[model samples]
Target: MAENTRKGTNTTILINGQRGAAYIKVHKRRHIGYLGASRMMASSTSPVDDSTPSPSADASLGLTKPTTHLRIKHAPFKLMHPTYLEDDHTTAQGTQWHSRASRKHLYTVKLAKVHLDKPSTDAEKATTSEFKIRGELRLRTCHPHSLLKPRLAWDISFWVAVWFVCGSAAWIINGFLLFIPLLYESSSQGVQAAAWGFVGGTFFEVGAFLMFIESLNSGHEELYKKALRSILNEDGGTRKQERGKLRLFGLAPFRDIGFLGSTIQLCSASIFWISTLTGLPGVIPGFPGTSSVAITDVFYWTPQVIGGTGFTIASVLFSLECQKAWWKPNPSSLGWHVGFWNLLGSVGFTLCGAFGYGSVGNSWMNYQSILSTFWGSWAFMIGSLCQLWESIWREANT
Candidate 1:
């Protein structure tokens, strides 16, 4: 009985020890699993926390924090998995996340929104629309020919007027000084009038010549430069061509007038000096000459008397040419009003020639006086008319 009892007790004790060992094994396994789960959660959360600061702290500091910690979650499984052992990726992500987050926290802030009301007044809107319309019109109207032609013509005309006015003034002053004495002696009212008319006419002629030359030179230079820049096959400025034709065909004859005037002045100057020096009979047939058929007579007669008729003929030809230039078949060519004035000039020249022939005794004097009177009166009247027309046009346009 005692042995059996001892054996039973030993058996029970062995069974209890086995159960305790099993229980201890289970408890250790459970504790190890919990610790492993906690370690894994801590590792993941640690990297996330390191990457992003607390949102409340960021907001209070007026910062914008980056979510770089999220990048690790998006990385390829092969890199995150143990099989790949992507040590560099892990380190790089951690570093980038922390740096980006810190910088964002320091500087990033939200921008304030701005709202603007639309224009309130009808008048303001209308003004804006008008300005826009005008701007569009200006842009659309930027044509080369339309823009350049009028401006160039105006410039050329201005220079022409300046030269004409200056030359006219010079001629009048010089002629009056030279002719005052002769005017008193000539009892023939016609001769006296012829002398005064010649002086006045010469001034106008000189002005015309100077103005023509200046206009031609400036116009030619401008046209030449413009041609170089113009498209190879295009018709550029025709003002140059028209002006050139006028210069060659119409104005060329007047060049003779200039030559005649220059010669007369030279001869007159020479005679006056010679008479002062030689102490010869100063009372020539023509006060400046010894006889009516003296050196002075020849000098004065050849250009002034003879050339005057030639000048008139030239002026008529020029008027016709001007008509041709301005009144061509093309509608574009018909704008210039200068042709009418040129025609009028021709008429004045013809009338002057008739009157001069009747008044002057010398053939040369008759020719010169008439020629001078025609051109002078014509240019003055036409130029004045043109000026008036221009002023009116400008006023109307404005």
Candidate 2:
């Protein structure tokens, strides 16, 4: 859309491609998710009183400019991951929704200023023209430039997968030990099972904590953005205020599905610690005692229920983050697969928590709960393995 500003003329680009041309993955318009060109309405908090004016349309779309041929904006879009924005003078002067996906699959969406390619026909001295730009969409590693890089073994994803795998494996064994009555009847085996559960729960808490921390700087793109700005020094606004507030704790009530999911998951893991740790034979005085069902319920069962519920919510949010439609699976999306299994595990854990409550002496309830735990742990392990595999081979087939 064309509009006049107090200082100069500025064009408000909408995502629908009504005013300009937009391309996904540099040419592939048929994306699997809601990855779209990003546009931001002018905000009162803009660092400067004046917004960056849209460049005047020349006889050509600045193809003659020294900066190189094309004047179009390139935005990388990842259909499999949550959307984020990276604003730099290299593209434009405003924020836009973008994707910075895998190394090989660095799918970038380009929004070109086709209108500015020609001089206005009825001009009294017109600086801007009007035209609809069009381009084919296709995925290619040789082109579609992006700043995103491949994952490393020491990255947050790797650690998260490692911890989850260990934790899930431990829980699987613990569940099995309790599920079999003969094994559980032996006091030594029961004690050992509790010990294993404690270890598993500890590992879960650590992994969940890491995930929440990772979300603080989701995708770790901010660091790269800052690094690039140090060299380019574009826009002249290097102050912290102009860059935006520190998102160390994930600001706002409810933004970013991954952030909310990780936060909830972390809290759940922490709360569940109460049951796993205290239930150890010597951790607490009244814990692991057959004498009082009420005490066991208070310390163990209650926390499990609360944690399980939280985990379920988190898992759902995570799954939702990976989907365009909540009911349908994203074809060929590894992130979606990871979410699917985690959601299944969350459901199992929820059932386990529900059945494990009330009477500690109910054999039926115990068996059902243990069975749920065993299945849930297996599901969790599978998801963890998938994540690990994805993290390790991010650029393999991208």
Candidate 3:
């Protein structure tokens, strides 16, 4: 029994010894594995330091030593094996740092408010204000070149002179025609013929002159030049449309001056012609020819002549108003002043007074004759003279 017991104890001791050896081996191997893993992790976490100086620093400040304390973190997985992982991480980090540094260098911190340090002076303020006022005036007024051009001035002067001269001539001719007939043996017949001629001639002359003036004042060339300039000057800038409305429309004061003048001329011519045509006997009671003509005819002819003179006076006054427009300092207003007045005079004298008078008296003696023969002629003559002075002024200025 003792021997068997001893043998069991020996076997137990051997088994325990074998178990101890195995545990020691496992512990040592585990420690060695942990040590290897730690070395790999430490190397992976460490950063590479560059020995080159930063290019962004000023070279004039002197050369700077490369920084050595700088470190970069690297991945452990890359260190475990030879691979392209380290290269990619290095390139990406380098690019990111370079971009960040560039951004920092681009911005400069300005320490002073430079613009606030300067204040405007009184002279500068005055100059700026004056400039603004001048600019506004330029925008509102007509173009300088357009107004000052010699052609426009010449046209205005020519038309005005023509109207004045023609109107005066018509008045003088009508008077002559009416009076010459009264000096002959067949006074009645001679007067009648002269009267008809006077009225007819006035109408034809005035109409022709007016038509000519209208043709000359077409404004086609001026408009074409303006349009051409606009097209050539366009260069992606904002453009404003130009206006083509007549200047007289805006200038109300000068509106009726020409009309008044023309009316005077028309009335004066009509009266002289009608009186001559009717061949009313002289005031002598025993005078030769028929007294059958109505008393209305006697009174009518006299008033017609008187009324025409009144209209002529009014025309003279209105022409003075037109002259005012021409004298304005603004050159742009000059053309308009001349154009509208000329138009008014032309239409009122020729078309309304002269042509219109011919259609009156029913080819013998009509109501229109009484209205036009005296008043129209007188008005035209006086108005024309007034315009004559205005033209003279314009010419002198030129």
Candidate 4:
């Protein structure tokens, strides 16, 4: 079988069997609106009407039975999409856009089998004829995979990175404030650092939510298509597929790597809030959250360790979405770079958490913890910057 996916009026999938080639011509534009408060349009080109002239009317592809099983899988991709193209979801038509907001107009675009009708002539039946579609005939079929992807465009996704950059930059500022004569030499600085962290955590929460929403919006289409197909195919004309689309709050992300990553990141930020809020000098009356090293580690350091661990786990999940495979790295892709730097930042925080324990017992441990926070905060800043660049670079060239 031969396949051509080049940009033009007609794309072909060739299978030379008995006589010659079997052809399907695809071209149409499916437009959608309301992507992150913008009327940003996404256009897709699919086969509108079967334009390929049939070689002979004796044998032709027709939809006589439910043999057409619309299956969707990544054409040449090894990451993200490969996860959703499972057997249970093959007919499910589960597909999503590039999380970075590229491929604004691209969707699942699936194709089921096209059965050839029985040949009218015995001679033609013996010939093992290939295929042909009449010019006036119509076949509403999905492709093997999405062959055209538009370049990344400006969308709600760009701002998702911006918020992340803001959040990371705030953490960097707090890290800088930590470099004082002693851990809490100046209560004012300790309070200042806590304030920075709180601000940063707030920003992180916002970014994570927005990122989750972005991924959710993209994923909704898969369910939407599945629901529509259900009605047309009469699998169950009920609203079961329609009801599946309503995944509010944080319930839907578990099955989605991207959504799950964002949700975890959001939870990590919330955990940080516990430490940041309690660490303030006057946050609570008699309870000295950051006032004394003798007890500060109990309230602040423990949550720091827990939250840092959450970040590490979330980073791993995010990185997995971009890696070529679990053992291989994909540094060429912008999504990979975003995950790479975040992974580095998570590492720094993990080291900080390790050194942060029993700070009062050892001066070296105290100094190392502070040093790790300083470096880790800056690494986070770098990662956020990379994300910002990626959000813009997601421009589609298709």
What is candidate 1's lDDT per residue for 1-398, written digit by digit as tens? 00011222121000011101100011111110000100011111111122245442222111222311111111111111100001122353221211111111211111111001132333223222111110000000111122112222243334434433443343344334334434464333334444444444544454455434432332112100111122112221111111122242132222122223223333332332232222123433444333444454343433343433443443333233222222342222121233244344434444543443343467556444445443555454554355333322211111
What's each prediction's TM-score? 0.31, 0.60, 0.29, 0.60
* Segments in model 1 whose C-alpha atoms lie over 4 Å from true places: 1-156, 162-202, 219-290, 294-297, 305-380, 387-398
Q: How many backbone collisions does model 2 have?
A: 7
lDDT tens string, model 3, 1-398?
00011222121000011101000001111210000100011111111112234553212211122211111121112111100111112233321111111111111111010010111432223222111110000001111121222222344334645555565565456544443443352333434434444454455345434423322322212211111123112231212323333232111111123333334444554454453334334542322233333443353334344533444454343334323222432223332333344334333333323332333335333333333433444544554554444433321121
Write down the TM-score for model 3.
0.29
When sorted by lDDT, best at the front, the candidate numbers are 2, 4, 3, 1
Taking all chains together, the TM-score of candidate 4 against the true structure is 0.60
In model 2, the runs with Cα more than 4 Å from the true position are 1-152, 181-188, 219-253, 284-289, 396-398
Sorting all predicted structures by TM-score, with the top scorer first, yields 4, 2, 1, 3
Model 4 weakest lDDT span, ten residues long? 30-39
lDDT of 4 at 13: 30
Model 1: weakest 10-residue lDDT segment is: 133-142
lDDT of 2 by residue, 1-398 (tens): 21212322222111222211211111122111111122212221112112333343222221211211222232112222223322323344342332223211233333222211233232211222132232221121122233444646576657877898899999888877776654457533678788899999999999998777656544323212112122112322222212233244654223345666778999999998888977788765655445466666777777888888888888766655555456655646666677778878877777877887743767687677878888898998888888777666643223
Which candidate should be chosen as best, given TM-score against the real structure?
A: 4
lDDT of 3 at 351: 30
How much does each candidate deviate from the true structure in C-alpha RMSD? 39.8, 12.7, 40.5, 13.0
